[model samples]
Target chain A: MSAVRVWSKPARVVLVVAGVGLGACVLAFLGALFLHVAPANSVSKQYRAQVDWVVYPEFEQNWKLFAPDPLQRNVAVDARVQTVGPDGTVVTGEWRGLSAEDWAAIRHDPAPSHLDQNLLRRAWDFYESTHGEGDAQAAPGSRGQLAERYLERIALQRTGTGGGRVIQVQLRATVTAVAPPAWSREQVDTAPHVRELPWWPVQDADREGLS
Target chain B: MTTPAAVRAALPRLLTTLAPYQAAVVRIGTAGTWGAYLLREWGNRRVLYGDRSPWSAELNDRLLADTHAFTALSWSDGRWWFEAVYLLALLSAGAVALGWRTRASTVLFALTVLSLQNRNVFLGDGGDNLVHLMAIYLVFTRCGAVWSLDARRRARRPGRDPAEWGEPRALADALAAMLHNCAMLVIAVQVVLVYATAGWYKVQGARWQDGTAVFYPLELDYFTPWPELSGLLGGSLLVTFALTYGTVAMQVGFPFSLAARRLKNVLLAVMVVEHLAIALLLGLPFFSLAMVSADAVFLPTALLLRLGGLLAVQGRAAGWWVARRSGRTGGAAAGEPVEAVAGGPVEAAGEPVGGADG
Candidate 1:
């Protein structure tokens, strides 16, 4: 059988076409990644706040994946706000310490408290009634929004000095997970160096100083 | 008829016969897969376009700024006009498939497709990127030479040398093959890394061993298209345990399967299902597509050539008819061998070769 030879012109054209297709896919992939970087008000937004700050000084490590969930993945975080006032006041506050067993569970499973039956046992029935079963994963930010609108019932209040006002702030923060074991103690210490919180309009100066 | 002598004598001829078949299969498989992908993408391009952030709105975004490599294209404009450009690319790809002015069309198609794919890699639902990569490799091959309009035209021409149409004579077939081989390698490596990473993460968790961990993924409401199924599967402690352990095993085992064909295909099928399930349940369309396309490398070239044969048969028939009809007048076509003419009606070797044999 006779064979037909392919010439340079057609070859060049095919390569050009293939190159274009590849280029387009590449662009699309990058665009999607860019979208992930934008702040979103979606339910996923709550996962963002769990990340107090992304560390890595010279190199910003984009953690592609972590144990549990990508969003719930723990980075070696170092968050140091002015725990007191802007006046450099030394501070002491109530910090919830996780027991060894609780610490282990938190490290492995970072599912939202609303979902876990045992974690939010005290308010399980109330939570089940108000929210759907396993809705604890709604995330802190979204939960805060919902709580503000509907659940105005603050179960606790704090009375400090100065103006002597009781701050009815809801406590939703919990130790969801720990940094990966691959992150050594020393590495975690030096890795995420937190800076002082910048001056913003302090919504509640007393709350900021205390909480 | 010693075994060694027979094997040595037959090897070259065997390889020679196989090359065309292999090339043909590659053309066919590529055409089908790429054709399907292009059609789907084009059909959904409108939705994709609607989903995109307007180019004007995100001109100064940090991601775009960081991609200084595209500075020459002056992409620093309003919005990243992803959808508009992608539509143009799909049209170019169709033209390439038709083999209309094949060389130019293929190049244009590749560029446009690659650019669009790169622009929105994240949003891709299925194996579109892999298909794009395959298309790129196909462009460098003799794919358009056989099943394309280019082949039809060339076949019609009176006396063009067959050697001229051979891909390497013009485009260096070996280099093209090497590029394809490299792509396959990259794909394999990437798959290995993904599985390895996932397995590593899973093994770290306590529930992976206890079998309780499966419920978490199953219970992910976002992906609970059929909550009952998740409930059933999630409640099954044994299935979850097996899944955790098996996932890591399969990932680490994939690279080893490449050594043999049967094992490779089996592993590849498993990989495909894994990705398919991810796409169906997790709504991770992009990852699924990229992974599936990568799996195409495991597909043997022989199958591809067979598919190409099916695609090119009509062209082949038309070509043969033209050859037979033209042979009556042309005496001898440019590449017709001496033996072929000798075997023709002119029994006498002394007769002059006319236009039909020219």
Candidate 2:
């Protein structure tokens, strides 16, 4: 007299069918995840075409969780917006701190979400990894294009409305040197290096509501 | 009996026989872990997933479409709708944590997590992926079979034969049991894979090979929460090198060590200590907690029960002392025999009050 005996035959059938269906789904999902994270061997690549979609957005992950080497430099993202004045004069704003906002969000909080902790830094990393420090055009479908789009949205969100239509946007990464250990009396260069990108014309797609 | 149809019939029975109480433990661990994460990140929900995100709805929609990831956020058009979904996700997570209607709640919980994580995919780390996978797998497991409201409801049924409740052999019960066993195995394997990959990757890096990798992170401003402590630890090259190599060895040995019970227990203890250190030193408590919860699946049920027994014995002794101090006529409260409370076998004391299975 099992618990399943309490249910009618039809009910048992329905439960079994649903359970099998769910199990299949889980197996497929896990398979896709495995393929996505598997080492880049020929076998893995063969399955990539079939399972790439399953890996995207959700299951796609980077295993560099404090591995190899931890972040040695503290990088901050900064933005400057060029606006038109009432007299139709071009006005350049000061370097507004974008990463500072992230820091502020999590300053007093004990447990900050991964977004507050890594979003801005990863966004900058994304851009840097795709497009090096140069005025190279972002190739279509490349991660560079995606990174540009992501940064553009962040710049627009930070700038906000009410300011005269922003004509141009400039993004930069400020990398500060971390202090060396006391034992190592190494005189490492402590200067901050600023890598600035060319000002891109603000397109309608860059605007929040317009997009 | 050797035919395919007979094999199919036998498969369910095999699975039922093989099913252990481990799935219930994994369920509670995962549910508790994710529940805590949701609560911790509740205040920052807007920044991470809501309208306040730098990644706008249109951008999120495009990403979702391109990635073909399904999320409720894409369907949500307004701020209020998003907020409503977030609230529902929180409540559903609470329900799953309590193991109320666990099967349905597990499904809902996974969906909500997927929706939120997909909405802002960049706001995640390794722990998020583990949590995501575990939530989905838990849906296929018999998570509500033990230590759950559903279990209590089954026990309290009016007019049921008590013996029938102990060993359920029906088709649906067998299937559920099979699924639970399979899912628990998958979860254990998943954790092992994560560690193996992480360990192997570290072995390839020059800095890690040379043992200087740990020192660099401690020196970094981003990870140096306590500068004095980091400095003190990083000052010693021997200590840094030992820690670096020790971590690598433990992680690489974990999968193989699982075959030996004593070695596995020792490694598990070491791993827990390592994770605790990471949580405190690196300020990544949530991630560490998630990993530790996943690792808890390896703990043996017998060991957990013994620990529980020790605690019970201590509690009864304290109770006896309290009774003596009060100068009560009867040494035992409620007319219960003192020996019954003090000298009963662990099994005869009551139902097993522990979690996990080796």
Candidate 3:
């Protein structure tokens, strides 16, 4: 016995209309994604307004996947917190390696999550990309502010209020050059260099969600 | 008929004539890869995006307020809600992989992935971006038309012949097919664009041009998971130069190779091997896997079927051997037909499946 056909004329009509609309939407989205990832140029600028809405937040992609040059330096993020004791004595904690912690977490696992591979690195990149080489403070409403807040949040999350009231947090990046390829006889300096950020006062805003 | 009327009449017929198996290929590749990734990273869900994340919901909300990137974490600042969202995402991914209620499940899967990815943007790499793009495109494709629970259910149901379905149903199905075909073509183009763009950028770089580009990455301590292996490989100057030049050539030539079946297949095989090496040597398995999955769209349906058949034969042989060794009859293992195991449209061999031109 033949089964009944469920889709009526009206239902099919609705389906066609919806399909057309959805198809157009998908096409538009694809165009936006293409334009968003394409190199920064005058052509891309034309579609920037339309593309930004589609590519931001989730779909914001960086296609520089090991292009031009790969990372040749191992960077370690170190943080030191100064806490005020009951007697008003300023006590500073030893430098804790934040990037080392991330490295340790990811080293053994073959399929480390994107977070393990990128979080600390991207956090550092966010800071570096936003701030000038010698800039002390991030400009308000700029990308630097976002990076500052992110770093601050990371600091607060990592170093909790276990010790005496934390007064200040100082973060620095230690860069060590990787050994030169065995094939290349070029003697590259493998020494560690430190770039220190100015000590940031632990503000009420920084500690907002920590409690 | 006049020219415009003839073209109009022909277009619908052309769309309906096309089958959905090609779309199914893309769906299986993307959904299956994503499902596996989700399952593998299940334990890290909380660490990646939940309350344990360093960036709080408030911080993310403040930063991403203008982007309208509303996440489940931002919706309710509770651990339970985060867990619920994670669970829903996991379930939806599985459903998408199984192609059960695929149309709805695809949407749910995309939203869940987006919400989680956006919640902690720092945790993702290029793989996540590719997944985002694929997920959006998959929604428009007739992805569950084959090798799916939906397909099985439909097959089981006693259905009227095409004559009884009437013209409206036929028209709707044709339109759907047309959209799926178009979406699949777009996906192919996207993959090509990625390769071409990457190649274009690489060509402009002095390092890539100088043939020392691959040398630096090999020397990197972070990427050198196996120092000894990297050293052995990087020690050979010829190998390094060959790899650097080959990568650029393959990437730049990919779009052109797509037109030629043999060259495309050869290039794809080389790429798969290259990605595998990267996964093993560089410790970027997910990224390699994601790229490999994307490349699967270019593989012919006939080739896939042959590979499937070979695997099935080997599996059955192994099962039969195990049964025999255990002093039991291999009848049960031998009873299942190889054809059943090698599922999908075997008759549609040499058919243009998942190819952009097709």
Candidate 4:
């Protein structure tokens, strides 16, 4: 029934072995994938290590896309820098909307860049997920500090308003809840929540690409 | 009925290449998608993955060490090393889309995608995620067996068919076919899993259950790139409800729909339209493109071939030869009219469009 066939008996034996071996591997791969992607259960939790073994690095999949719940709040990220002059005088610059810049680049453009679309937004998410309310770290220890560094680097390049060498940078986010639709009777508080982060001094490594 | 003798007889059947048109189209769509993404982000390349990245080389290396991921860029942290890998990624993506030296280009394509993606995981959205998965999966598929430069080269050579060419070549082809068929199955199953997981997860949400989930995202300033359109859609109850519940129904029922050919075609069409709308309305062209391309594997083969033929005519008009004929290299008669999709003798009767396998 197959189009290509090896007539030799030895070769046929080899083909059978190869096919059967591959089929088992395929089954195993699928099983691991299922365990990795499926909603958490006892079976998946029990085999967590085994699943991660097969699914990590490559073949890692996350389809939680707007699932469980979509983002209900709009978080606008802002950054400001403190510059030190040659005479040692310093002035704090006005807050610049980093998220606003991304939105401005995105507005009305049929094809917005991945950089404009995701970089700032994901940076915020990464930072938010790693840190608890206020300054506490999330379950991922030390990652909060890493996220802060990543966020700090992002803030440094974005706020060019400070003029002189950037010695310190601070970030703040305003989260506004999305209003319920007209027809829906869902009562929702639309107050904006503001959280200002602590000032972090700029490291030499953070200023690498900045002039 | 399921005895060892029967299994032995059926084993060689694995040598048949499954859904060549589907595989080839998936390859083209994914490679073209990723290449276009690289080009669009060319200005942001430094900020996204190179030395200027917030997630610097040191940080990326630290993360990689923890994850134990395979990325060629991790081998060297020099600026030149980054630029070289970026150039190679762009070149290999183009080569893969063109189906030139597919065997090698696919590997290079995978390498570039993984390298660049792993460098800055934060730079990705759902689209980059899809491309990342596709890059790894495309490595295992003989996606260039049809509708590609490799296929054209084989067609021109005449004796390149495994049945005619003996020994190692034949053995290699057989092995490729076995792997390819398995890969195709895995891709289809993977897509199904994605939908199933997404749909089931959405069911747990109060917003999704009540059908107000779509409205929130559309109303979001971040997602509302097209303000006027999104505002109109978000304000309208009819459109919002339809989209919210419609998406859930579509995603939830997607796996079941595959069992029925007519229903499957309808669902596939709807999914493509939905993804396209997501692209325009949500300002996620790359993600939408990736999703649409991944869904292409389930598209009717005949429709894909027709699309290929149309593209060929368009290409010829523009004074370019765009690998017009498909399956010609896999033992289709050389004289077979190019008007048709130009497939091999295996599907002599043309096999009723999108039924069964779909």
Candidate 5:
């Protein structure tokens, strides 16, 4: 490469010092990054907060892409809703396969949009992580309620406001295991397991765009 | 060995602009990937980031407030705000990819990447993470030095030498070069960490150990965008096992192979092909594109130069055909600057085969 340019001797020295400092900072950052991304261990655990401060938000790393084990099951999100007519007759709607639409949009398309690939999946995952087996808030007042809100927005937006004034919405997932090839000896139960979530009452905020 | 005279002699090497092509390719790669992805998702922008997003602005704001995270999306939950940031991201990605006003655009590139990706972190995959990291690192690089519009501006300048510049300008240029080298170094290290960690995690999986990991994902509805194509590929148990074992081997051995040029090139080629397969088979175009581009950081300058040459030749032929059809002459104009890009800096003293530069 052509030389960058020339600086005076003292200028060179100062720049060199600054460069050295920058290098050290980068090294420190890399160390923190390694700790943050590495599987939980003693040293990383010891410096958890410090590492988080450095690694969270922007510099955070997650290299575990289909690692340790790839996701072996197909989880499809389904939603249903209750609606009130002009005569105050409440109607419970059929469970709509929200995720089935996603798969339909995805199938045969080489470049599926993030809306189809991640919106329902990630929202459902958020809800799953925050809620317990009984559908109670696993960590109430933190992010559980927020996760529920996120899921409700996604599912309601996909299924629409139940043909009239919406009253309540509920979601569930059908997780089916991918069957192994005939040649392989590996045997996994190819059964579809359905998990129903608690019904969340439709809020004023949920009605804003439903019309 | 540590004499003052020797130290003084080598001190100036710090200011030398290193890996200009690597920087250019990375700039092009990351920005191209991001720009294409955004365009591809333009129809779904509202759902991905705007009002239709499952994670609403108020939710994003609350989450950001608790985590103390950084996202311009949290600035306002309004559709107008989301639209503005999305537009800016699209523009920045284009400008950075084209290397137009590169310094400012690179900063914008970083901001847009962080703002968009961090807004709804769960929406991304492994490739998004790499793009996220690269956008930040690319800011610290003098990535516009070669194959850039900025480089063309410099080439067209009255005096094309930094040495003839004013004192302050020269000093800044030197300092910038030093920073660029360091940034490139860090980028290289980051890629190594990614591979090492991925490899480490893969080796621990029982399916990976038993050589069946690659076969399972191909059958899943989510990953199987092309079921027939996937079925054809996954039909052979031997082929599946080979791909499985081969992936594990390549990833784990990648860091060690870096020091050996041929081995590294082979690994890089495999990685690039592997990413291409991921894009097609798994239907993760953006992720695979991001990864392939990130891997550009490790490519030697010579190979890039050769590739640039081939592209330039093709570009000239296309230009010639267009100009002929338009009744214009001098199609050779398109081929000239590519020479400047290839002949850049005379390969920089040939620091070993493993050096980031030629």
Candidate 6:
């Protein structure tokens, strides 16, 4: 029996086209790979907060970007915190907006400013990473909490070098009740939906202003 | 007593009994190969290019600072090995695509794609995940027959009549067919759910029904492309009403439209336009891409073929006269070669029963 050659003129044309498609696929893959390896940022990506510590009751209702319905479009939660220096000095701060840009500085490198500005975001991120999302913010007695607290304790060691009197304080702002497109709510609300919770869940005593 | 008529009826039964499995083998093999190709391509990207690009650099920095960068896998070094499993799985998929040692390749492709997708659930877009999920189902069905090396070898094997295809075992075929059917169901249900939920939400507000909601997105400076397009659309109450009602009607009527090609095409076109508009107006590129790709899922096989044909045309082929002539009859009656059926069986299978058709 003779071997039936499947190749025809049209087939050759198809082969060339497919080859081009395959080449395009390769090019895209390479481009993606370059993006993966390059020392740039996921800036184009919208912000998705995986909070380890919410400091407020309303934060629970805040969108869980880590959850199944990640894009719930809730109120922005802007936060600032002040801490005492190793020598027991205090610091004060004002309520700064928590735009993604501000978070980017802290979330990018999280080391000294020279390394990258993503310090606070990186710390929270590290906590979430080391401890699972559920365990990262555990109560102090729990092993998860103990492990986390120790990590924080270690992290605090690097804070005092920045100032004569080092203090770490946080001011938190929680946006509330963002309305969704009437048609998009069900897709957005597969997770437990929160209806209009108070914006500031923290009482005056809970906040450290200047003292 | 088994009459001739009863025997004739039995032919269909026998054919169907075997055909389901055969069809599944075809689907799984092809899907696996395609999936593998996709996986290799995607895996290579994650491995080789994880850090150089702006997005990856930013993401890497964020993951590193967040301590989410490293994982337990061998490929977690932010290098080629970072998602080695995804790459290996993709390579397995390519082998499955080629129909070489198919049963093993198909199974590997399924598991590998599943694991890889599951591993980085957070970073995935809807299209990426949907493609993987669909691939799993496709691989279970045998898809490699026409385009694969396996078919070539099977044709040459003696005593294994080419008419009686040497496909995967019977049980594998059944399982694959079952998986494909289930995947179809899942995709349909997902679309229905999205529509129903959106419809229900629309009922919650007067604005949605009143057409105000249509203008809301456009009014937002980010989404209105040719601010003039938004103005034109918004100025007309009819357009807004149609847009709002159209979304609700599409969702509520999707289940009904499944069997009707005309309705499905109309609905799909609306969805594509809506997504395209969103992509232009809002900087939600990922969302637009995901939504548009998801919309693509509804496209029938014939349409995909047409698209392939259109794309195949080169610069000269795209001339106005060429396009008009090609567009006139839409290649339906074109005496094009049967080779366009890329995944069909070899000539041995294509031969007509009476041999007159060939």
Cα lDDT, model 4, residue A203: 62
Give every prediction's interface RMSD: 14.8, 4.9, 4.8, 2.5, 2.8, 16.0
Clashing pairs in 4: B127-B287
lDDT of 1 at B339: 26
Tens digit per residue, CA lDDT, model 6, B1-358: 9999887554322211122223323344335434533543453344223322112232333333443422233234344554466566657766765556665676676666554433333334333444454454444334443334455455455333323432333223323333333444443444444445445555555666655566565543223335556567666666767877776677557657878989888887877787666555433333445445444546665665444344334323344444466569684533232232332333324322111000
In model 5, the Cα lDDT at residue A47 comes to 92
Off by over 4 Å in 2: A1-38, A50-58, A100-109, A135-143, A159-165, A176-191, A203-211, B1-14, B17-21, B158-169, B306-358
Model 6 root-mean-square deviation: 16.5
Q: In model 4 chain B, which range of ten residues has the least summed lDDT?
A: B349-358
- CA RMSD for every model? 18.6, 7.0, 5.3, 6.1, 4.2, 16.5
Where is model 1 chain B poorest over a 10-residue stretch in terms of lDDT?
Answer: B349-358
Q: Ranking by TM-score, best first?
A: 5, 4, 3, 2, 6, 1
* Model 3 CA RMSD to the hidden true structure, in angstroms: 5.3
lDDT at position B260, candidate 5: 100
lDDT of each: 0.41, 0.69, 0.72, 0.80, 0.80, 0.41
lDDT of 5 by residue, B178-268 (tens): 7888899888888989899889999999989887788888987777789899998888889989999999899999999998999999999
TM-score of chain B of each: 0.57, 0.80, 0.84, 0.86, 0.89, 0.53
Alpha-carbon shift of residue A115 in model 2 (angstroms): 4.0
Local accuracy of candidate 4 as per-residue lDDT tens digits, B205-305: 99898888998888777787898998888887788888889988999999999999999999999999999999999988888998888999999978876
Q: TM-score of each candidate?
A: 0.45, 0.79, 0.84, 0.90, 0.91, 0.47
Model 3 chain A: ten consecutive residues of lowest lDDT: A1-10
Estimate the TM-score for candidate 1: 0.45
CAPRI band for model 6: incorrect
Q: Residue B20 of candidate 3: its Cα lDDT?
A: 55
Question: Share of real interface contacts recovered by each model?
Answer: 0.06, 0.44, 0.48, 0.70, 0.69, 0.00
Q: What TM-score would candidate 4 get against the native?
A: 0.90
Best of the two (2, 6) by lDDT: 2
lDDT score of residue B190 within candidate 4: 87
